[model samples]
Structures are given as structure tokens and as C-alpha cells.
Target chain A: MTAPVDVSLIVIVVVITALVFDFTNGFHDTANAMATSIATGALRPKVAVLIAGVLNVVGAFLSVEVARTISSGLVDEARISPVVIFAGLIGAIIWNLLTWLLGLPSSSSHALFGGLIGATVVAAGLGAVHFGAVLSKVILPAIVSPVLAGIIALTATYLAYRTTARADSGTVTKGFKAGQIGSASMVALAHGTSDAQKTMGIITLTLITAGVLSPDSGPPFWVILSAGLAIGLGTYLGGWRIIRTLGKRVSEIETPQGFAAEASTTAVILTSSHLGLALSTTQVATGAIFGAGSGRRLAAVRWSVARQMVVAWILTLPAAAAVGAVAAWVASAGTVGIVLVAVVAIALAAGIYAVSRRRPVTADNVNDVGDDAAVAHEPAVPAR
Target chain B: MTIDWASLGLVSVVSLAAGVAVVVLVSFALVGLSARVRPRPGGAEDGAPTLSAGAGTAIAAVCLAAVVAIVGFGLYVIVS
Candidate 1:
């Protein structure tokens, strides 16, 4: 066994890194709940994020389910060292930051899972990983969840427009805008419960591997508290770039479309949760918006932007896995190796943030996509 | 490992029923309430009232109540 000091220090570093990943997850996914409401002027950007942040914290406290077994079925936890988990986290954070820089809505959960899989294979070999679980849990849901949500959104949107077709256009818009606020709030609250729980699980998993906690033990109060606050703070900060991509660049959303998309997202997420199918909120939200946009007018949907998102979704797992493999090699060197990896990871994150400042997207102009953002990803999207 | 095909199918059905129900109920409530408008001369939808004010408001109230009930049920499911 390693020295006592080394074990404790590793535990501390792992916990801190886990919380940092949680924060990024919160901010990266803010668009899932608020983008549509913000796009249609149903809720102010600042107010929308505030609601999401508070609800996320509240939701975290609401559930104390088994977080220690987050990757139990996907990988052999017994062979996973704290250093391996730390390396995995570094990979996930790097991917989350890179995707955020590009204003893409890739799955944060998948990044985390992919990182763990990559690190585990490097640390314990291919036999330790579960390919069947990966196919059924990670890859299948990534492909299926969005398609299901999109279909529902399409049907819901079509019915919404059809039933309201005869009503006063002005009244219809006003009514749906009000409805958007309620549905969007539910999404925010639901996001809080699920996403925040993942962080708590990671922290608990780290403790288990580090010998600080036994297997199958629930997260302690402090783990839950810190995870919740970290995620809440991140959500409050908001990922404005991704919000711009989802709200403005996805489609020209009207109030009715926003309402339909949000409602569909909420319904799919809630139903999946009840049925024990874990899906990514980012993917689900994007699909709902896609369906809503095309349901109203196929011509309004930007195919180029859709293609870019698809590319990002397809690349997320492999890219994060590649990074994780590299980090695993470096971290396996010993305690000193992780400190070096952490330092480099922090510097890279700072560089990404610095690059993003070149064309900042804040709450005031979040709905208006910049010409460069559109032209780079999609030339067909004219400056709004 | 086998995929949870049964759960996935159930999710699709439940989501469709829940999502479509909410959208339809809200639309109906809006339509019902629109009948109560006084119909100003310059308004885009200036026309004779399609239904009595009492009847329109009652329909809107019932539809909106159903929506609220459905949303409440959703909350219960989420919590449990």
C-alpha cells in the first residue's frame, strides 16, 4: 500500500477534480433547459439561469441514491485506482471545455463515461472493461434517446399548431409563451436532480477506490453539499456560447415552437427516468428543438449546423477516450505524475477560456448569433 | 447485455401521451379563452363571439385544470 499521506492527498485532489468536472457539467448543460425559453423571449437569460441553478441545488438534496456504483457495471471498480479516476476526470474536463469553446452541445455524461472506459482499459487492460454494457448503456442511448425525443417533439409541435390554428395569432403566441415558462422550469428542476447526482456519484466512487469509503456506501452529506453547490454555481455562470448555438443557430424558434420543444424534452426525460433509461439532456433538448423546427418549417432548419452537432456527438466518445488514454499513462507514473497532469489540464482550460473571450456572448445578446459563429459553422445562416 | 427494449418502448408511449396531452390541453384552453375576448374593432381577430362568456371561461378552466393535474402527476412520478 502507498504511504498514508499519499493516499489522503490523492483523495483530496480527486475530490476537488471531481467537483470541478461537476461544475463544468452544470454550465455546459444550462442550454438544455433554458435555451428555448430564452430564444423566444419567454424568460430573460439571467432569470432563466437563476431558476435552473436554484432548482439544481434543490434537486441534488432530494435524492441520495447509490452513487458509489456509477461505473460499476460499465467497468471493474475493484481494479480502478484513484489516479486512474483522476486521469479520467482530466480527460472529461478537457473535452467539456473544448466542446464548450466550439459552442457545441455534446454529452457531458458520455464524456465522463468514455474517459473512465479509456483510463480503465489502460490501467487494468481490456478484460476489465464491459463492452456489452458500453453498447447497451452508452452508445445505444446516445443514438436512440434523441430520435425518440425528436419524434415526440415533431408530433407535439404539429398538434400544437393545428389546434391553435384558428385562434387569434396574438393570443396563441401569448398563451404558449406562458406555457414555455412552466415547461422550461420543469426541465431545469429535473436537470438539477439527475446531473448533480452524477457528480455526487463520482465523488463517492473516488472515495471508494481510494480506500476512504467502502463499496456500496452512499454519498455523505459533505459530498452531496459540495457537489450541489459546485453544480449550482456553474449553472448560474451559464454556458452562453452553447446557448447561442442551441437557441439561435438551431432554428428560428417562435414562442409556440419553444413551448413544444421544452414540453417534449421534459416529457422524454421524465419518462426515461421513471423507466430506468438514462439519457443525455443535451442530446434530448437538441433533438426536441430539431423536431420542433422541422415540424413548423423544414426550410427554417439549418442542415449545416445540424451536421456539425452530429459530428460533435459522434466524436465525443472517441476523442475523450483518446485523451483519457494519454492521461492514464502519465498519471500511472505515481503521485507526482497526477500533479503534473492537473497543472497542464488547468493551463489548457485557461487557454480555452482566453480564446472564448475574443467574441463573448453574454445574457444581453445571447439570442443573436454572431456572424463569425454562423459563417464558420454554417455559411447559409445569415446574420440575425 | 440486452437493451431495455421494454422500458424504451414504454418511455416512448408515455412521453408521447404526456407531451401531446399537455400541448393539446393548452391549445384548447387558449381557444376556449379566446372566445371570451371583447373583439375590438382594430383587433386582428375581430368577430362575433363564438360562445357565451360563461361557457368559454368554463371550458378554459376545465382544460387548464386538467393540464395542472397532469403536471402535478408528473412531479409525483419524478419524486418517487
Candidate 2:
């Protein structure tokens, strides 16, 4: 480890970058919990995000098991430096912005893991990454959780429709809308429990590498509080672009379908969080939404849109890893190199934001599918 | 490094079961509510329902209570 005095400055810089990444994570994933709720008119856009933001804060205080996993289990803290963690954060934030610009609901968790693993490999060699842990905890869970969520949602949605087939349509819609609000709130809370801890773990790992904290220590109370607030703030801002895609472009979500999708997402995310598995909330939500679509009728699903999201999922890890590796190489040269990387990252982020402003999607225009000609032109899925 | 296949299996089974159960219960509750005969807004005479309205209301209440209990249990698992 480096001398404590020499590394303290680097540690502070790294922590801020991690918080920035956490902020992007918050907005990038806001759609996962609230998209269907917003789309179905169960809650207004502003009210939905406010509720999600508060619940996320409450959920962040729920458990520390996942934090322990990221701090010590993923990569060797001794081999990597705070600078490396900073580079990894840069990679994740950039990937998140790129995907968000394209309105794709990619996995923020996977991007973080990929960036960290990639930067570690470049800085400390391949052995620094525990491939075994990655296989069991990260890779395997990513594959299974989404498929499982999809199947459960499919069955539940089908059963839901069948059970209520003879019911008065007006009463059924009202009841399911009420149920959807409860389920969506649970999903938001579950998201806070899982996603916020990834940042906490990265910050804790940075502190450990700086010689400020011992190895394998859990996040301090302050770390948890700041991480929670950062994410909550991001959630409140909302990711209207991705929300539009998930809510309107995925399929026409009825009240029952929305309820089923949110419930399945809640169950899978909470279960994984309890087990300390860092599964992707985005994937689970996407899968459940598709499942809900398919359950109603295979014809009801827009397979082309689903195909595009899956392609994004397949690319997120490798793409983020590549950027992270390049960033680590550049940042490792010296203090000057680190400053250059930070400058370039900020410039690139500003450029992306400028581009996004050209055809902006905000809460007022989020559900305006008819006015947005591009979204309207997509071939419609025939509802059964 | 070693994959805990057992834990993986447990998570998968539990999540799937819980997801399906919650949906089913909520749907059944809605169905039960629909079965009950609500007095019309214009004060029309209530039509006789196939199932007794009292029984349907009872069934709906029980199912909704079960869903609430499960959600509470989920919250407890997170905190403790």
C-alpha cells in the first residue's frame, strides 16, 4: 500500500468520482421501478419519482450484505489503487450516458462490475480478478435471474387475466391500478437496497486501498448516508428518455400487466439482495415486462424492441470493460495523466448532454408517443 | 470462487414462487370483489349474484390481507 499521507488526496478524488457514478446509476435506472407505473397512469410522473426517491433512501439503510460482497469479493484490494477505482468509475459513467442517450435500459450494475474488473486487470494483471467469484456471483446470476423473472411474470400475468376474465372491466382496472402502486413502491425500495450499496462498496474499497480503513470493513454510517442521498437525488431527477422506451415502446401495459411486472421485479430483486447477489435490476424489470407482455399473448409483445434491449445487455459488460481498460492505461502514467483523463471525461459528458438537448424528452413529453414520430413509426404489435 | 449451487437454486425457486403467488392472490381478490353485487348509483334494486355478496367480500378481504402480510414479511427480511 502507498503511504497514507500521499494517497489521501487521491482517495478524496476517487470517492467523489464514485459518487458521480452513483448519481448516474440513479437516473439511469429510475425507469426500472417506475416505468410501468407511469405508463399505466397509476401515478403521475412527478409523484412517482418522489415516492421512488424517498423509498430508495429508506431501502439503502436496510442491509449491508451486498456491500461486503463488492468490497472484498470481486477483486483484490491490495493489488489495485484508488486511481484505478477512479478510472473504473469513469468507464461506468460514460457507458451509462451512452446507453441512456440511445434510450436503452442497460444494466448499471453489470457496467460497474465490468469496469472494475477491466481496470483491475490492466493495473494489477488478470489474477487480481477472482474469476470464480465473478462466475458464481455475477455472471451466473445475471443469466438466471432475468429468465426466472420472465417466466414467473408470464405465468402470473396469464393466471391474473384468467382469474379476472369474468369480472367487470371497470372494477378490475381500478383494483389492479391500486395493487400496482404498492408493488411499484416495493420495487423502488428493493432497487435502493441493491444498487446504492455497489457505490458504498466501491468507496469502502477506495478507503481501504488508501490505508484509511482496514480490509473487509463494512461501509461506515457516513458513507451509507451520502451514497443514499446521492442516489435519491438522481432518482428524483428522473431518466425520462429511458422511461419513455420502457413504458410506451415495450408494449401497451394494462393495469394487470403492470402489477404483474412490478411484483415479479420486486420478488427477484429483494431475494437477490438478501442473498448478497448483485443481480441487475434493469434486466429483471425488462424481463418481467416482456414476460407480462408475452403472458397476455405472444402477439402482444414487440419482439423487435426486446431484441434491441437484449443486444444492449449483451454488449454492456464487454463495452464498459474496454473503456475501463483504456482509461486505466491512460490514468496509470502519473498525476498529469489522471488529470487529463478527468478533463476528457467531463468534456465528453458535456458533449453528450448538449446532443441530448436537441430532441429532449422530459416528464411532460414522456408519454407523448403520438407526437414523437420516430416512436409512432415502429410497427405495432398485434394485441390478442 | 466456488459457485454455491444450492443457494442459487434457493433464490430461483423462492423468487419464482413468491412472484407467482403475489399475482395470483391479488387477481383472486379482484375477482372476488367483482363477484359482489354493488348497489347501483341510481338506487336501483341490487341484482342477485351467483355467489353470496357476503362470502365474496370475505374472500377478497382474506386474500388482500395475505398479500399485505407477505409484503410485510419481505420488508422484515430486508431490515433484520
Best by DockQ: 1
**How well is each residue in A1-384 modelled by candidate 1, as lDDT tens digits?**
332454578878888999999999999999999998998999999999998888888877876532433535678888888888888888899999999999999999888888888888899999878888888867887898888888888888888888877676677889999999999988887777677878888888888788777788888788888889998889989999999888988887888788888888999888776655557889999999999887786677887888999999998888888788889999889878887898899999999999999988889889876565553554432322
Worst 10 residues of 1 chain A by lDDT: A375-384
Per TM-score, the best of the predicted structures is 2
lDDT of 2 by residue, B10-39 (tens): 888898888889999988888788767464
Model 2, span A165-254: residue lDDT tens: 866667789999999999999998998899999999999999888878887788888889989998988888999999998898888888
Sorted into a CAPRI-style docking class, model 2 comes out as medium
- TM-scores for chain A over all candidates: 0.94, 0.96
lDDT of 1 at A112: 89
- Candidate 1 stretches with Cα past 4 Å from truth are A1-7, A65-69, A370-384, B40-49
**Candidate 2: segments with Cα more than 4 A from true spot:** A1-7, A371-378, A381-384, B37-49
Query: What are the DockQ scores of the candidates, in order?
Result: 0.69, 0.59
Error of 2 at A116 (Å): 0.9
| Root-mean-square deviation of Cα positions for candidate 1 versus the true structure, in angstroms | 3.1
